[model samples]
Target: MAQVLEFKLPDLGEGLTEAEIVRWLVEVGDVVAVDQPVVEVETAKAMVDIPCPYAGVVTARFGEEGTELPVGAPLLTVAVGAPAAGGPAAGPREGTAGGAAGSAATSGGTTEGSGNVLVGYGTSEAPSRRRRVRPAAPVRPQAAGPAPATAPTGPDRTGARNGNHEGPVPVISPLVRRLAREHGLDLRELHGSGPDGLILRADVEYALRAASVQERAAKAPAVTPAPAPPAHAKAAPEGIRTPLKGIRGAVADKLSRSRREIPDATCWVDADATELMRARAAMNAAGGPKISLLALLARICTAALARFPELNSMVDMEAREIVQLDHVHLGFAAQTERGLVVPVVRDAHARDAESLTAEFARLTEAARAGTLTPAELTGGTFTLNNYGVFGVDGSTPIINHPEAAMLGVGRIIPKPWVHEGELAVRQVVELSLTFDHRVCDGGTAGGFLRYVADCVEQPAVLLRTL
Candidate 1:
């Protein structure tokens, strides 16, 4: 008889706790080889393909597309020792018990066990023969009355009374529960729309939004007049909503934490980048591999950090000590359609302009394609944000948390300036430094920004450090 093995969602690393099913590659009863990708999931960091470790006939799939499953949740179940015949399993024969045994006999004849170790299962050992059993039923959310008929509701109203409910709440992520508790919203009062009626973060957020709207409506007077419509009609419906669950949510959480925890301050300086622009043009003209403007700025940043190491450090709140890093793992912010992502270049201080240019190009392409791995998106010791692409003059950037500072580069445009005691148009750029005040004071931050400005004003200053 074929033994059915369950495959749970593997840990995609980088502290990701859950992933949403982007697409399913296999269907129930499809024959699959070992290490074949069965599903593609999108985590907060990136999209990952999950491979099935068992080589057999797929008997069941757990979640549908667009459903989010927590780590260790069952993804699918494969019946090992099934017939090796291509296509779905055949119906049971006269001697077979419920056709499962016959399907196993047919598929198991030629299928070999996979030695791969997935998130929750290890296939290194010899296969054990066991009868296929049906999985236990999942906890279903109690059906609630009709809500606004706009979106899905959460738990029922009386289900949460006195916390005396018998069964466990059908919530998946702890984050959802925490959010409801923080907002004083009862989870049991809303209905869940996820598979098996599992509560999702979006369901809670929608409930909260609905409650807030109702409360405001109650407070407002009933005699208010409607305003005139604008020239262009709204594209979306009145109650159209987008969930902040994936990359957008991750960015929101990080930025919020940074604001809440870091004592940050911003300093700005206007620098004449004429020399830097000229230097870049000259290098590209005489270069084997063309150097990028961002690369030049990054080289200058590494040199500046060397001179003022205080800014290249993070505050260890638990130890209550400032941790100064020796190597610069440089992170550059890239804005993509999905949102803003920072891809890190490892040991950036040691890389030359050519290497940095190549690395930046590779990472930028990957970022645009949404193919950057979790490793490439994390472990940034320092960040260099060039917001000039947006045509903005300057901005006080929020420091990527745990990183002490972020250097923001503005658009270098032609502006009237003093050159050789004569008025002339020069390429001027604004540089802003947003640093964690806990790691260093304004004086240190000023020194770092000044060094960077000096290099921009005179590229020759960077050559000495190089």
Candidate 2:
């Protein structure tokens, strides 16, 4: 009889029920080596490529692209000798049970074609299936130097650093990968507590938050109540309120959580935007598309992040941690026909004003057309919401969830002001920055807003900061 070996989709991480297929790297009949890239999967948090562990000829794809497959479901089947009659194994494989893995090895004996499959990953339960059992203890390699004393001692692998391992291996699903990438976490370093060492999305989130807290102690100063907003009459409701269903819906949830969970402290600064307006007009005269005050604000925000790193941070409420980011992925609120959208500008600190303006244009157009993907909407460190576009003076804007702060930009209008002890008309814009009181103090928020104002009033100041 011909023997066949089946490859089931392992539980990429703990608590990862399902994953969406993004792309397939291999085709049917292609000879793949162990650890070769075979498929790409997308979870809620990130995209990860799965490598093949056993070398064999490609057989068949589990389903079409974008298909959501449950954990332990057979993804592909490869024949070791003569091909088997049935399709890929259905349900969790014998040793690969996610929920109750300890009982799998003894219950199902290894068959002739079955290879040593890692248990504790997910697999379907079927009567005909056999379990390939390995040694009780996993063989871990030693490092060249003495192991760090701070290594966590636990059954969970999250805290365990894997800087030593190499080679292809089966792992958790897309959601776990996404969570790890967003929080700048290392999945390999994490010692998973889930069945068979599968890292769960929640596990990654917990690790990230723990890391963030350590950073906050190093950055944040003593917290103080933010200065109160200037008293004004109940502002008449003039703007439209649209329902946020998709991208906007996500934004709403994030902001609501930030406000409800974290203590918010807001501060204000007035900036003379005359120089930025003149600079923009000159650029437009040189054949560039006319950039708005909001675009100029984006450039200033990016520059500010480079000068003050603490402003670009995220607060983990559950972990009681704060993570300061080095890169600036500036997110600006774009009001479109659909609703309010904040398309992110990746690595904002790396791009120049011209390049930043161009990128905003592209993202805005894409967002308005309803073509932005999930990746585009993820990974924002700081956000800018422009109420000026609709001709408002200013209001304390809510912070985006996860992030610690958001800058609100108001309209630039000619106003009477004293310059050098003389009353004159000057172009002025109100800037408000609302930050999580738990993560940042009043002094830090004030300093950050002042820096942004200075950059706006003198656009050339960015030359040194950028």
Local distance difference test scores for all models: 0.74, 0.64
lDDT of 1 by residue, 133-219 (tens): 221322211122344454345443222332446765655444456678999987767556543345556667778888888899999
Choose the strongest candidate by lDDT. 1
Q: Compared with the true structure, what per-residue lDDT tens digits does model 2 show for residues 156-188?
A: 533756556675222334445656777676677
Which stretches in model 2 have alpha-carbon errors above 4 Å? 1-249, 287-292, 317-320
Off by over 4 Å in 1: 81-117, 120-238
**Model 2: lowest-lDDT 10 consecutive positions:** 106-115
Each prediction's TM-score against the native?
Answer: 0.69, 0.51
